[model samples]
Target: EAEVAQSPRYKITEKSQAVAFWCDPISGHATLYWYRQILGQGPELLVQFQDESVVDDSQLPKDRFSAERLKGVDSTLKIQPAELGDSAMYLCASSLVNRGDAFFGQGTRLTVV
Candidate 1:
C-alpha cells in the first residue's frame, strides 16, 4: 500500500514575517528532505535528515530558513523575516534508506507580499 504525505496546500505571508510548513512522511521511512522551488525552476534540495540527524543543509540559508525532522517521523521547515525572493513552493519528500522512488507531499506554495 502507498501512503500520501501531508502539508498545508498554500500560504500567504508578508515580507519580514515568519512562516512554517509541516510534513508527515510515510511511516517507517528513514530519510526526510525539504526542497524549495521557484517558478519555472526545478526543486532545489534545502535540507535532508536521516533519523533525526542532519545529513546535508549546505544549501539552506541558516540565517532565515530552518528545517528539522522531529523524532524522525514528522518534519518542519520555517522561514523567519521572509523576503520577497523567498516566495516559492516548499516540498517535503521521503524515501527508504538508499532506495529509489521518493514520495512527495502536496507542497506548500508560499507567496510573500
Candidate 2:
C-alpha cells in the first residue's frame, strides 16, 4: 500500500536554530498539504499545494516558515530561528483530488527548547 513518507519522526532544537521536515506523498496524488497541530488543538493548515503551485497559505507564518513542493511531488517544510512556541506535530497529507480523502503521514514532532 502506498503512503505519505515523513522523515525524522522526532526532532529537538534550540530556540533560534533552524529545522526542516521532508515528505513524499503517495504516487499520483496531486494535492499536498502541510499542517501544524499543537497539543490539545486541531490541525491547522499551514500550506496547501495543488501540483507545484501553492493554492493557499494564509495561516502560515511566512516570516519564519516556508514550504515547497518542487516538481509537484515530494515537499519540504522549513523553519528558521525556531521558537519554543513552534513545538508541535507537523503533518503532511495528500489527496488524489481536491477535498478528497487525504492520506496522512506519521507526523514529525518538533520540540524547540
Candidate 3:
C-alpha cells in the first residue's frame, strides 16, 4: 500500500520563528484536511480541501498560519512568527469520495521554546 508522505516529523523552534510542514495525500483521493491536536484535545479541523479548491478554512488561524493545496494532490502549511501555543500535532488526512474514514499521517509535532 502506498503511504502518505510527510516530512520533519519533529520540529523544535524558538517562539516567533517560522515553520512549515508538507504532506502528500494518497493518489486518487479528492478530499484533504489539516488538523491540529493539542495534547489531550481531539484533532480540530484547520482546513479542508476538495481537489484544488478549499472547502472550509474557518477554523484556521489566518493571522499566523496559512495552508494551500497545489494541483489538488500535495499540500503545505506554514506558520510565521510561531508562538508557544502553536506547539501541537499537525496532522494531514485524506479520504476518497466513497470512503468516510480519513487516513492520517503520524503528524508533525512542533515544539516552540
Candidate 4:
C-alpha cells in the first residue's frame, strides 16, 4: 500500500485555467509539506503545515496558489489562472516533526498549455 495517496496522477489544462491536487498523508504524521518540481529541477517548497497550522508558505505564489490542511488529515493545493510556469509535478510529503524521514506521495503531474 502507498504510504501517501495523491489523486489524478496526471492533469493537463490550458493556460489561465484552474487546477487542483489532493494528497493524503500517512496517519499520525504531524507535519505536511507541498512541493513543486519543474523538469530537471529539484523540488521546491511551496507550503508547510504543522498539524492544522501553517508554519511556512514563503515560496508559495499567494496571488494564484493556495494550500490548506484544515483538519490536518489531508491537504489540498489549488492554483487559479494557472500559467505556463505552473506546469510541474506537485508532491506531497509528511514527516514526524519536520526533521525525520519523509513519506512522499506519488505526486500529481500538471501540464498547463
Candidate 3 Cα errors over 4 Å, as ranges: none
Highest lDDT scorer: 2
lDDT of 3 by residue, 1-113 (tens): 96677777999999999999999988988899999999999999999999988999999999999999978999999999899999999999999977799988889999999
TM-score of each: 0.95, 0.97, 0.95, 0.95
Give the runs in model 1 whose Cα sits over 4 Å from its true position: none
lDDT of 1 by residue, 1-113 (tens): 65646567889999999999998888988998899999899999999999899999999999998888778889889999899999999988899999977898889999999
The deviation in Å at residue 91 for candidate 3 is 0.3
User: Candidate 2's residue-wise lDDT over 1-113, tens digit each?
Assistant: 99999998999999999999999999999999999999999999999999999999999999999999889999999999899999999999999975679999999999999
| Cα misplacement distance, residue 47 of candidate 1 (Å) | 0.1
Ranking by TM-score: 2, 3, 4, 1
Q: What's each prediction's clash count?
A: 0, 0, 0, 0
**What value does the lDDT take at residue 33 in candidate 2?**
93
Over the stretch 30-85, how does candidate 4's per-residue lDDT look in tens digits? Answer: 99999999989999999999999999999999999999899988999999989988
Q: Candidate 1: give the clashing pairs.
A: none
